[model samples]
Target: MSLLLERHGQCLCGAVQLDCRLDNSDVSACHCQTCRRWGGGPLLAVECAQPPVIGGGDALGIHASSDWAERGFCIHCGTHLFYRLKAEPHYAIPVGLLEGEDWSLASEVFIEEKPAWYCFANQTRQLTGAELFAEHGQPDDA
Candidate 1:
């Protein structure tokens, strides 16, 4: 199936909760410079089929990370929440924020920006930024 049934996750301080309809169980790693600067490393995130149902008081903070994408986080605890596309109904939530064991790193994007200091042993389908951006202006798959 293209979409997993449902998944639940929360911020580090439990100030924010999310009910997400995941597009798939597989996770993707973004090695782009923006991702690196945002998270200090590759962002291991899962794609959501639609906008997550977020429940939080005033602890949620959103930043326009780029012209086409935005990043959400917990203001109280500084937990990385989701990286979302502004032009589409797409959300990529950090795998660690969610509770699940079936998640696996399926692909890596912006391979050219990946640092040489670290590496993953798992064999994953990888694409450089140019290749990814050339795929109809988006990644071929989430």
Candidate 2:
């Protein structure tokens, strides 16, 4: 598959829209507690290559979820929009928010925090919470 793919998507109420180029077509899932609580399940993460073009008026709501990251949603529809680092321009968006092709489960982050109630059958690269922090830096620094 190509390294990058263009995609467009919007919130449930069409209040917020985004255009972006993504490097990974495979959608990764985040099992971190914050992600689980925020979205009511594992957060399907699709990282953007750069800042996305988000349009619409007064429809975006941003919450500083952590010292290093902030979460966004649609103010009108309450749809989860994105999870982005405060110091970085890139965004790790919910895979469900973007329209594209060739999507598959590639990896799972914060595997250690994943509850036993549900599990995916796909064999994927799994990383523990500490491992994620080790690679991306702790939540305070990541």
Candidate 3:
């Protein structure tokens, strides 16, 4: 038997809404410098097979954060939306933006880059930046 979980949420100002079908109830954290700098801390997110159904497209703003990834946010309230891979149909949506109680920590990426000042007590699989890249293939140098 299997279970399916779906979550719905909106931006800070309620300018954009998201309907996401999660691959699992587990959430992952990214501790890479880029993620830290982007959100002022680790990004706790859930993977989605495709981009969420975004409401109010005009209020959404996208930034090319890296050669292979782009970050989306609400322009009106400066709310973080989702991080999408440019070369693939992959997306990681911030857990905070979604409404659900089924989520649990599953993994942490860029473990080597995680700062020592903060830590999570959850037992999760950890992967360093190199390992993550090796599995997903490094982003183009473009």
Candidate 4:
């Protein structure tokens, strides 16, 4: 039998919830400064086919840390829920959102910007700024 696209997620308080179609398990750990400050670690996220049908979207607080990025979290419990790029318009749901499952599958991104104190060591791919920019355009290498 073909496997179904299973999905399940919850907020810090278990009050907010989500259910949706997950295209793939492949996840990304973002090491940008904004991510580090918001999540206290690399942000583990999975791109969803569509926005998860959230139960408490209203209760979620939005923090626009940068002109291009906005972060959403639970106001009551302060659980970081989503990281969204305004240009992309798609929500990068935190893998932690998946409450009780093996939510692992993220590759690393923006490792060059990561702090030295926290060592990735052997966790995920470490992408230099130049390398990441090359994947798209001529982003400033320096």
Best candidate according to lDDT: 3
Clashes of each: 0, 0, 0, 2
Off by over 4 Å in 3: 1-3, 139-142
Writing each residue's lDDT as its tens digit, candidate 3 over 1-142 gives 5555678989988999999887688899999899999999999999885578888999999999977789999999999999998877788999999997778999999999999999999999999888877677774233
The parts of candidate 2 lying over 4 Å away from their true place are: 1-3, 139-142
lDDT tens digits, residue span 23-81, model 4 = 77767778877788776787878877767777887787888876656787888898877
RMSD of 2: 2.0
- Which pairs clash (backbone N, Cα, C closer than 3 Å) in model 4? 27-105, 27-106
User: Mind sharing the TM-score for model 3?
Assistant: 0.93
> Each model's RMSD to truth, in Å?
3.1, 2.0, 1.8, 3.4
Model 4 spans > 4 angstroms off: 1-4, 121-123, 129-142
Cα lDDT, all candidates: 0.87, 0.86, 0.89, 0.72
For candidate 1, lDDT tens digit of each residue in 18-92?
989886788899999889998999999998888999999489999998777899999999999999988778789
List the lowest-lDDT window of 10 residues for candidate 4: 133-142
Best of the candidates, TM-score: 3
Ranking by TM-score: 3, 2, 1, 4
Which is better, 2 or 3, measured by lDDT? Answer: 3
